[model samples]
Target: MAGEQKRFARFFFYLRNLREAALHTGARAEEAEDRGLELLHSAETEAELKKLEEADSDTLSYVKRGLNRIAFGAVNDAVKLVFDADNMTARDIMGMDLFNVSEIKISGKNVLEIKFFDRQKALEKLGELAPQLDGGGESKRLIESIYGRDGDSL
Candidate 1:
């Protein structure tokens, strides 16, 4: 009778853990969907939408692996909250200091106009490279190298 009771207890424990994992997965999915929709609505161009889709795909794959690890019970309690919103959320991506950001306006499709607080200073600093901003081959290569084909790091 004692052995049977022990088995039942162990079964319940596993059940509870799996339930928690499911809840976590659902919450993350909801948050991701909300943020994704917001990004889509704010997107001005098809290119921007495509970029968001690519990011979503990468994030989905990462989350799937993490969830699989959880299912196998290989994850520690501390790691369970790795995706906690407070620790690291989609909002964190745009958590820039308001003071440093003077303005963010959509100038046109596939274009975002961001004005920094120290606009004059910024222009002054970039004055030397202003000529290169005029579609210089060096500038183009530099940007392409930093942001590869899919805008993923090279």
Candidate 2:
């Protein structure tokens, strides 16, 4: 009887300690979760949101910079196209409303921009230089080849 009582008492003591530890751990976890959520909420800003979106989506800013640098170099080599070198920049095209080369700057940088006037010419230029932005043409061919003649799956 004494041995049994000692065993029960030891079991209760261990159980009580386990329960206390579990409660403290759970409370700490909940507090950490709340702090993480608060940090996420605090990170809400236009610039931060843009960076997050660019990281997730196909912003194509790097592609655009490469294209601009190539074009600028080509222009300097081929023709004496004069430009305010001091004021030369690459910006995003806000909308492709019948503009040859329009710019739209977001967060002091360009995210999505298009430099095109016609379909064939744009395709030609894109095919020659910025093939990544040739989504309309190459994508169509790719989708058609993959999805089949129906084009419904695309």
- lDDT (Cα, tens digit) per residue for candidate 1, span 6-42: 3323322333233233333332433633533333234
The whole-model C-alpha lDDT of candidate 2 against the native structure comes to 0.36
Question: Candidate 1: where is the Cα deviation over 4 Å?
Answer: 1-117, 136-154
TM-score, every prediction: 0.20, 0.19
Question: Candidate 1's C-alpha lDDT?
Answer: 0.39
Residue 132 lDDT in candidate 2: 56
Where does model 2 exceed 4 Å of error? 1-61, 72-125, 128-131, 134-154
Which lDDT tens digits does candidate 2 get at residues 1-154?
3333333233222222222222222324336334333323342322444454455355553444334333321121111112232333333111111223333223445333333324354345545644455445676677789998658985
lDDT for each candidate structure: 0.39, 0.36
Worst 10 residues of 2 by lDDT: 73-82
Q: Model 1 compared with the native: what TM-score?
A: 0.20
lDDT of 1 at 117: 46
**C-alpha displacement of 154 in model 1, angstroms?**
41
